[model samples]
Structures are given as C-alpha cells and as structure tokens.
Target: MVDIRIPRLNTNDASYVLVEWLVDDGATVESGASVATVETSKSLEDLVSEHAGVLSRRLPAGADCRPGQVVAVLTPPSQASPPPVADPGRPEGGGTPEAAPVSPVAMVITAPARALMRQHGIDEQDLAALGRSLIRRSDVEALLAGPPAGVSPLVTPEATPAAREGGHARPAG
Candidate 1:
C-alpha cells in the first residue's frame, strides 16, 4: 500500500487546489503516471504516482490540499485492501514538521536599474560584472558613478542651440 501526498512546489506556496484527477478510483495505474492535476499560484502541475498499483481511494477534486496531505491511497492488485494510513497529517518518515503558510516579502528592483537593464539588454549576470551590489537604486547609481575612463560624455538633444553651435561666442579674456 502506498499513500500519495500532495507536494509543495515552492517555498512560498501554502496550499494547492486540486484541479482534476487523471486517474479514477480502483484503476490500475502505472508507476510515474500522472494521477492528478494541482494548481498553485504560479502554474498548474501534474502529480505522478510513485508505484504501480490500483488506486484505492482518492480525495475529491477541488479540495484544498496542503503540503504532505495524503490525497490518495494505492493498493497492490494482490491485496484487496491496503492498510489505513498511519497519520493523515504527517507525510512519510514523520520527520518533516507540518509546514506553516508562508508569506514572503515581495522584492521590487528600482525603476532606474530596471530601465537601464532593459535599454542595454543587460541581464542580471552582466549587471553583477559591474561590481554593483545589485539590490537597490543606489547600487545602480554607484555603478554609473563615473563614465568609462577613456570615453567622453556625449551631448544630447536637450543641449541648447548655442551649445550645439560649438559655443558661437568665444570665452571672455
């Protein structure tokens, strides 16, 4: 007899919604066969069977499944019924404590860094090469603190017409 437990896909995920069952109760399922579909906040994933056996019982679809929750029980063909699961709350080995719902803080990279990276087609790895901390706006500003040693600053459209005319009037003596 084997118990199938709902698995946690991510650190911040607390529960999954059972979307559908691919296999029916009492059906003989092969090992590694997808038995059910579960939906987390990020994506939908299929749950696979660990052993080849007859699916004895399955929790109803649309149920909220927590990590380590036994969603189904499988019985070998030779056995009419499998033994009841030892603990419904704990998963196998009983070593991992039940996980509490996790609320992680969202990280927001500063607008300037995001824009600069986008414009330059620079990836996170490339930004790291600049020796910047890569955490906040100040880090990005620090990276841009000075221009490249040999390169000179270029004029932009915002330059005044007189400046564009190459300083029409000479400096006062």
Candidate 2:
C-alpha cells in the first residue's frame, strides 16, 4: 500500500483545498497520475500518485487538506481491498446523497467561494445564476456586491480611490 499525501505547495497556506477528483475512488490508477488537484492561495497543483494501484480516496473534493496529510492510499491490485469507509453503515462512496456535484461536468466552486457563500448566507441557486464554468472567490464577492461594476456608479478618473488617496495608477508587474 502507498500513501498519497498532500504536499506543501506554498509556504504561506497552512491548508489547501481539494479542487476535484480526476478519478473515482477505488479505481485503478497509474503511477505519476494526477488523481486530484490541490488549490493554493494563488494557484492549483495536481496531486500525483507515486504508485500505480487501486485508489482509496480519504478526502472528497472541495475538502480542506493540510500538508503531509494522507488524502488517499494506493494499494497493489493483487492486495487491494475495498476503499475503507469511515462509516460502515454508509454506502460505498462517502458523503450524503445531497452532497452530489452541482452539475455533471464543469463548474466547481473553489473552497474560498464556498466560504464566502456561507458567510453571506448565499444559496447555491444564487451562484447557479452566474452560469460560469468555474466559480472562484471573486465571483462570489461580486455577487454579494450586487449589480455589475460600472453599471450604476462609475468612478471617474479623478474620483478613483487611488487617485483620491494620492496614488497613481500603476501597472501590476
């Protein structure tokens, strides 16, 4: 058996988000395969499997995983057992039936977006209104802000926050 750990992608983030699973739990996977994705503060990195075996997923997509945490295990096919479920009473897959994906394909709400939605008491139906392929933290914030920017209130060059604060507009490097 092989342990699939969550690597420390950056120095700043203590925990990372499991963006999505590339393969299903208890499925066979090849060595060096990207089984899932870990989302950091700035980017997402693939969680590669070091061993080719039957995958036993311990964490679901969209859950928080910390560095050095075992998120899955790879068992040699000959010795592979059923993916251990925390709850024997539960079905083969983890999570409640209501925990199904919002859509069959595309449109994954990042952890930050989920947090913001919870904080603001926003509903998933509200986000469904956006009809985006991917929903990020910024998208949720924009929804909370209401109306499209530059629709009702357009800040003039002179009235810009930077300008008013005596800071000039500078290109980001």
Candidate 3:
C-alpha cells in the first residue's frame, strides 16, 4: 500500500482544504497522472500520482487536511476493492475512470486561465502553436490581443464584441 501524503504548504500553515479530487477514490491510476487539485492561500496545485495503483481517497473534498497527512491510499491491483460511496464529482460512481482528454501541448492550466478559455470558447488545441505546456491567464490575454498570422482566432467576431463590452454572448434569436 502507498500512502499519499499532503505536502506542507508552508511552515506557517497547518492545514489546507482538499479542494477537488480529479480522480475518484479507489480508481486505478498511472504514475505521474494528476489525481487531485489542492489549494493554498497562495495558489492551486495538482496532486500527481507517483505510482500506478488503485487510489483510495482518505479525505473528502472540503475537508481540512494537515500537511503530510495521508490524503489517499493506493493498493496493488489484486488487493483493490470498490469504493464504498457514490462520488458525485465523478461520472461512473467509483474506480479509476479514464482521464479526461487533453491536448499534448496543454499543461494543467490555472483556474483563471480555464475560466478565460471557457468564456472565449478557446481550447488548448487553439494554443498549441504557442509552445507552452503550462498556460496562464496572461498568456490567454496576450493571445486574445493578437494571435500569430494563419492561426484562427479563438473567439467568434460576434462573441468578441460582447466580450470586449464586458457582456456575455447570446445565441442568435
């Protein structure tokens, strides 16, 4: 069994909330796969798995977890058991579900960057040529300001007008 301990955010801090679980508890995970998202007072970070095994969450989302706490447990394949509860955050209830598809060039982006992408209907594929693995809000801003020639604009012209005006886009009536 492998214990997934939460790293101390800082010497001054005692605990942090388990903001979200990217993978459901009792799911089979691959090494280096992003397993969850954690937040500190300063920033958000992804909890990546180091071993390929069955992941079992020890703490629920929104729980206050201390640094070096074993937030999860990993069991070898033959000894793994089904998760005991429904995970509303996941679609299939429990077990390691397949990871969401992401562009090869896309890194796990920041929340603000994600929000901006959602607002503009832009996907990581749209930014592939930028040659960046980790994308930030500033990068999105710069891209919106001007994309290189030949690259299609991320937002539609109609949506652009509304975005510029600080309003949301509407479907054509």
Candidate 4:
C-alpha cells in the first residue's frame, strides 16, 4: 500500500489543513488523480494519488496534516487492505503503556532526545529510571551505553588524577 501524505507546500507553515477530499473513501482511482485538497496559509492545492489503486482515507476532510503525514493509503487493485499493526508508541516488551508518565512532575524532553527515543524505542519507563525531569540527547546516549550518568564501570576513585598524584587520603591537620 502506498501512503498518501501531504507534501511540503511552503517553509513558513508547520502544518496544513486537509480542506476536502475529492474522492470518496475506498474509491478506485487512476494514478495522478487529484484525491484531496489541502490548504496552506498561503494557498489551496491538490493532493494527488501516486498510484492507480483503491483509496483508503485515514483522515476526514477537515484535519490538520503535517508534511509527510499519511492522510490516506492506496492499496493496489489486486491487494486487500493492509492488516492493522500495533501502535509503535506501545512497547512490544509487554511493559508499561506509552502514555504512562515518568514522574508526577512534567518531564521536559529535548527534540533531539525525543528523536533518539523514537529511533531507539526507549520509552518513558526507561527514561523514568534516569530520575531526571529534563532529558537530553547525552542522557539517552548514556542510558543506551549500559550505565547511568556519573557511574562508569571503568573508572574508580583510585583512577583519578588527584589520587594518582599522591594526594593525602584525609585533609591535612
């Protein structure tokens, strides 16, 4: 099935409105068909079908669409609708639900950190172990690297420069 998504119409708008759909849901149309009308801040443009197939509309006529967001899918004439898959946000590990809050306080995740989390399938439960309300990319990396921050398996106090330089074990009287 080919995904029918809104294209990047302009640089200024972060999202566009799906103004209308020219074709009905599950309608069979030829390639290059104008399937929907999308509205940007500046213009209303046609959304086209990439292939000749049966349209399966995912979003209604009036919906907000980000660039590359799949608003519809086109199943080839011979193929049946694709089987539903589990939500990506939900972990396959049979663990906590995706929306479970890490803490009572709001957690602020940096954009890069969020991207890394998605890429690595690291959810809030994994992040909650971090005990930090603010999550950054380095924190995620440290978690991915097999140890939490500041607690390295390799380095000990004896490995420190001060310890190796013959510093007193206790303060001088």
Candidate 5:
C-alpha cells in the first residue's frame, strides 16, 4: 500500500482548509488526478493524486490538513509502494525548503486619486518616493496643492482674461 501523504503545496506559513473531496473512498485515481480541493488564505487549489491506483483510505472532507500529513493511502495495482522520482524538485532526502518569489508592492489609492493621477500623468512610484505617510486622495491633492515643478499655477476660466491680457507676460527676446 502506497502511503499518499498530503504534499506541501506551499511554504510553512501556508495552511490549507480542506474544502471538498472530488473522489470518494475506494475510487480509482490516475496519476496527477485531482482528489480534493483545498483553500488557503489567497486561493483555492486542487490536491492531485501522484500515483495511479485505488484510493484505499482517505481523510474526510472539511478536515484541516497540514503539510507533510498523510491524507490518503493508494494501493498500487502491482507494486506495494510507488517508486520515488529521481528529481522531485526538492532536496535529495526530500523536505529541504527553498525561498519563495517576492511579490510586487501595491499601494491602495482612492478612486478620485486614481483618476487625478491618470489625468496628470503622475507616476505613482515617483509619488510614493515623496515620503507621504499614506497614498490617499488627500496626498494627491497635496501634490497638486503646489504648482507643478516646471509649470505655472493653472488659471481658472474666470481669471484667464485678466491673466492673459495684463498678467506677467514674457518680455520680447
């Protein structure tokens, strides 16, 4: 009988809540066939069987399964135990850990701020570097509070006539 252990789908921090079992006890399963669905904090993933055999024993659905815990046992047709693969994508003796990929940072900005940022062609990363505590709509407003770095303050439609006609006009070269 092959002891089909619940493979660790992720790092130690990850714990799975067994959602449901797709196959019932004694059900014949093919290699890499999904046997159960598990839910983590981020997503739901299917737990697939690694051996082609009859599922002789299994844990019921809704069980809180941990990494390296045996969730089921498969009785192979010919062999008593399944042969281990040459490279299981793990260390030689198995169970050595590897580093996880880092995810990109995303700042939560308000809808209005998003619109304003798009309108102004402001790079969010550049604004993030401005040492603001929070990237809120008010922060964007504060950035707009000052005149743009190289551009003069925008004149309202009401002030345009006076500003255009008599305001500080550039001297002739």
Candidate 6:
C-alpha cells in the first residue's frame, strides 16, 4: 500500500487544508493521477497517486492535514476491498454510493500546457484567445508569435523591443 501524504507547499509551513478528493473513495487510480486537491497559503495543488491501485480515503474533506501525514492509502487490485476503519474523520475503504467525482472545469488543461504557462508567464486570458478549451504547448507557441490584431498584447506596449522578442511583456505603469 502507498501512503498519500500532504506535500509541503512551502518551507515554513507544515499543514494545509484538504480541499477535496478529485477521485471518490475506493476508486481505482493510475500512477501520477491527481487524487485530491489541497490548499496552502500560497496556492492549491493536486495530491497525485504514486501507485496505481484502489484509493482509500483516510481523511474527510476540509480536514487539516500535515505534510508527511498519510491522508490516503492505495490497495492493490488483488486486495480489492479496503479494510474497515471506525475513525470518525476516516471513511471505510470502499466506493460510497452517494459520492461522485468532481467534474472538471471547461478550460481544464494538460500538464504540459501548465508547464508552458509557468515557463512563459502566459496567463489564462492569453490562452483563451486561442479559442480552444484545451490549452497545448503549440497553442501557447502560437500566442507567443504575438497577440492577434485588435487584441492587447500579453506584454506591455511600453516594453523594450528586446523584451517583446522573449515573449514576456511587462505591463506598463
């Protein structure tokens, strides 16, 4: 079984609130799948699964989980059923008839797109200009070619010509 710990979002912080589970309790998940979402002081991030198996939630939604704490467990397929737990904050490892996975947002993006956004400092509005719900690296590249006519450039108009060539434009004062 693999322990899904709350990752340390910052060096000075030790805890974060469990926002919600992307996958339902007792649901099967693949390695690197985003199982849960957590919120720290800085930002929110998905808690990914390390192993492919059935997920067993160890904490309810909105619980304060510390970094390195086991908030969930993964049981292999052969094991099937999750063992029962009477803990108030924890749920029995099995599918809950009432729970459903959270639906993704319309503009949900792939990991590569997110990485490109971070690297290029591209904002959501920039991607939205592409007129595509799913953002891709090539789409970002196209935007980098320069904003469409009549649209405000991602970089500030006052930016040095050299900065514009780099694809990052600072907003004018």
Best by TM-score: 2
Error of 1 at 91 (Å): 47
Tell me the spans in candidate 2 whose CA falls farther than 4 Å from its real position.
Answer: 82-108, 111-123, 130-134, 137-173
Question: What does candidate 6's lDDT look like per residue over 34-118, in tens digits?
Answer: 9988766656778988789998899977678898899999889888775564455446644444457886445545445566666
Give TM-scores for every candidate, taking all chains together and pairing residue i with residue i: 0.46, 0.58, 0.47, 0.46, 0.42, 0.48
Q: Per-residue lDDT of 86-153 in model 4, one digit per residue for the tens?
A: 56566576544445556475565655576766665566666776777667678877766666566753
For residue 117, give model 4's deviation from the true position in Å.
Answer: 43
Root-mean-square deviation of each candidate, in angstroms?
Answer: 19.8, 9.8, 10.6, 17.2, 18.9, 11.1
Candidate 2, residues 1-173, lDDT tens digits: the string is 88999998999999988888899988999998899988998777998888899998999777888999999998899998764446545676554333445755557788778776656555565677677756888987676566575565222334334556776433222
List model 1 lDDT by residue over 32-51, tens digit each: 99998776666678999989
* Cα TM-score of candidate 5: 0.42
All models: lDDT? 0.64, 0.76, 0.72, 0.72, 0.62, 0.71
> Ten-residue segment with the worst summed lDDT in candidate 3?
103-112
Error of 6 at 139 (Å): 27
* Cα deviation of 127, candidate 4, in Å: 50
- Reference-based TM-score, model 1: 0.46
The number of the candidate with the highest lDDT is 2
